[model samples]
Target: MPKHKEYTILLLSRVTLKAHEFITKVVQSNSAFGPCPEYICKCGNIQSDICETATVAISSVYHQVFKTKTKFSGLEVLGFDKTIITDELLSDLPFRPYNFQLGILRIWIVKIGCSNEITTNLAGPGFKSAFIYQYNKSRALFFQEIDKNHCRVTIYYECNAYIDFIEQNPDLVWSKIGILQKYNRNQLFELTNQYTTNLIQAAQIPYCTLNEWNNKEIITNIYNYHLKCCIIANINWYQFFCNKFEQPNTIIELRSALQLIYPIEHEIGERKFRAWKAMLKNVGCSDITPYEKDQSNVLNNLIRACMHLWTQRISY
Candidate 1:
């Protein structure tokens, strides 16, 4: 193990390592930053304003303190939401038998809002998300719950999705705090599904069927294009089908076509199926009730994974 440092610590995922490393920098700090103007937030319901984030960090083991500036940005990221605040609970947080926490602990004063340049008193529009820095590393984590000074809400769903992405694309990953709100939930899910869809072209995950793909050459050529458009265009699932099938252009047609692949159970699941289609028909599929949540519980795990990835990038 290397010598322990101040504002930072190495977060090791149960590597088969014999020992661990801890390094720290002068802690405590403050700053203001923003999302690039070129980026537009486009959730179906809420078009997020351009977000400007401010972070503050006070480093120490509860009350006894030392570094300040080193903890600045680390503290601010948590403040991005009310769910991530940090106080005493972080320092005294319970640990699993397999996990180890290293830190002087710290406090966060975060301000979150819809514009890098604009200011407002509205919340949920933004928050004071809280975070914790491991004693010898820059990687900071959302303070898990224990007390009010440390109210870390679990958003494991998004985090897990992020991890699945980086694990699949290990060489490089980039994250912006609370930026997930900028995308439509359905869009993000579709993007992930598309990302997975493309993996087939490079090296088909052994044993997985390319189930309904009719044209292999088309799939290979459009991989990168599909990825780029998924981010850049204001497209949705219906548009995707129209572009691909050149079939009919109604929700009925789209639903009917997709059902051919993942067919709706007619006899057994009549009630659920009726509810599912009724929701879309009445409220539009994009306005569907938390499809991401209903789809899988692993969504929470993905959110946690994303947080771990974020801390890894900036912690050093």
Candidate 2:
């Protein structure tokens, strides 16, 4: 590996051997001046950013990075969404046993909203609902062409989403920090997903399935914990279905639809379905007994059971 020089470049990924060669021959020579130029390259005696040779060199390195399909590029394309983020993008990432991939997966799990709590007051208009307040953050890619065959690239990444949210919801103080983190994480994931989805479509794959995140085994205790979180966070499982399917007008209709999609046996005198009904009630699925601790327990139990059942049935 070539040693770091006195350039302002921030290396976000492992430098390849070719990159090392380009940097040594081109970057080192140009930036030898006391002050680092905005961009530099070794060939064509070009010292300014306007050099035609530099453009070609930068393009070459840019293509090489994408051709290797670095994790930075993959994440830039696929997104951090639980379903969209995949290992395919991690193929060229320069780290061993890439924990960054796992970090993205964990964020996806949190974005599931299983542990996200929202009071009536906390239900103020979401960022999506306020277009004027909405924005995205991304890394800016810069290419410094050194010569006809050489150039160096750099990235400027900034996370403005969290700060923006805090600015917009100042009254909430630090209470909105978690909300901002959740939203920003999902946004990054979604952006990556969009980028990858386009690539997959271009490649003409029948369909690109997400990574094996959903297939991760959830132990009994973990499942139980998620259940508690769901209740505490006021997660409305019914809302998940309602968003996908038609919104049911009543609890009976909602229950009927759930049963149709996810069949549950009503054992003789077991009142197995009763608990589910009670919990749904708390989540506004039913008009009766909304927010009862006993009903919550029953609901948690039902959700835990459903976790296993759904894992077996769902593919995506």
Candidate 3:
């Protein structure tokens, strides 16, 4: 059995006098709230945008994967592209499974991204490891106004931990496989606590001076703003796929579309080349063949395929 911990932080008069207004302002400003690639959601482009972005920035998954440590022990939780797991990109795992791996691919759905209840799920199709035991875990956050000058925030995290293995297999040793129950449990607590506290402290800052909010009222899509920041941070690969899209699938045609430069141009080494192929494959591109080179059908498919990732992410 694994442990599930819940943590809470209640900031007293430390918060702004205008609880809802201050939070709204913080949500709109990049300096106050940041977005991580772990969880991205956009729907209707409404008031829920800041909530989604704040939720993502303060999530345990974001802290554990991006802020605290990229890799656990020696295993790389983030794949070659360093993106979080979405329902779309599950098939292209960079490495084969180990006996036990924790937090391999997780999704956090917030506000508009979910229905019924806001939740996060750790289980997905990418779990190809030799299954002996497993744990499905989730952490959720709640916000409240304590008073005119205060706020209350709580984080509830639990794990539906379980295992699956053949009892008759004598060679299956738990000790040798490196289980992450205790390690993950402890790390989740630390990261969740730190992230919550940081958000509180950041919100308490005097940021209203950035710009006066007149009677007209200002509106900004914080979730999309942070998402754009993340995309810009990874713009190279983001643009790479964007550019390669719709072009002929042939290696030469794709190369011309990319207009590769310097080391990448000279060094289409095995790793980089394989990565390109994997990226295309992840985007629903069919198997490329020499004869398939100028087919309009192939071109159309490629165009649609390139938009695969974007369409999944764009505001609905």
Question: Highest TM-score among the candidates is held by which one?
Answer: 3
> What are the per-model C-alpha RMSD values against the true structure?
24.4, 22.3, 23.6
> In candidate 2, what are the lDDT values of residues 156-261, reduced to their tens digit?
3353222322222222322333323444333332213443234323322111111211322322222233234333243334343344223222224334434454
Q: Candidate 2 or 3, higher TM-score? A: 3
Selected candidate, larger lDDT, 1 vs 3? 3
TM per candidate comes to: 0.16, 0.16, 0.20
What root-mean-square deviation over C-alphas does model 2 reach?
A: 22.3
How many clashing residue pairs appear in each of the predictions shown? 47, 12, 3
TM-score of 1: 0.16
Which tens-of-lDDT digit does each residue in 1-316 have in candidate 3? 1133221211101112113111111111123456322222222222222223334422323333235533221012212234553322443222222221235523221211111111111111111122112323443321111222211222233534333322111122222224443543222222223433343333322221112212112112321222223222323444444344334442334444434532343434434444444334433344434343244222123324433323332121
Most lDDT-accurate candidate? 2
- Give the poorly placed runs of model 1, Cα more than 4 Å off: 1-260, 263-288, 291-315
Off by over 4 Å in 2: 4-58, 61-220, 223-316
Local lDDT at 146 for model 3: 23
Range of the 10 consecutive residues with the lowest summed lDDT in candidate 1: 165-174
Q: What are the clashing pairs of model 3?
A: 132-164, 133-163, 133-164
All models: lDDT? 0.27, 0.28, 0.28
The residue-by-residue lDDT of candidate 1 on 159-223, one tens digit each, is: 33211112111011113223334443222222123332242232221111122223444433433
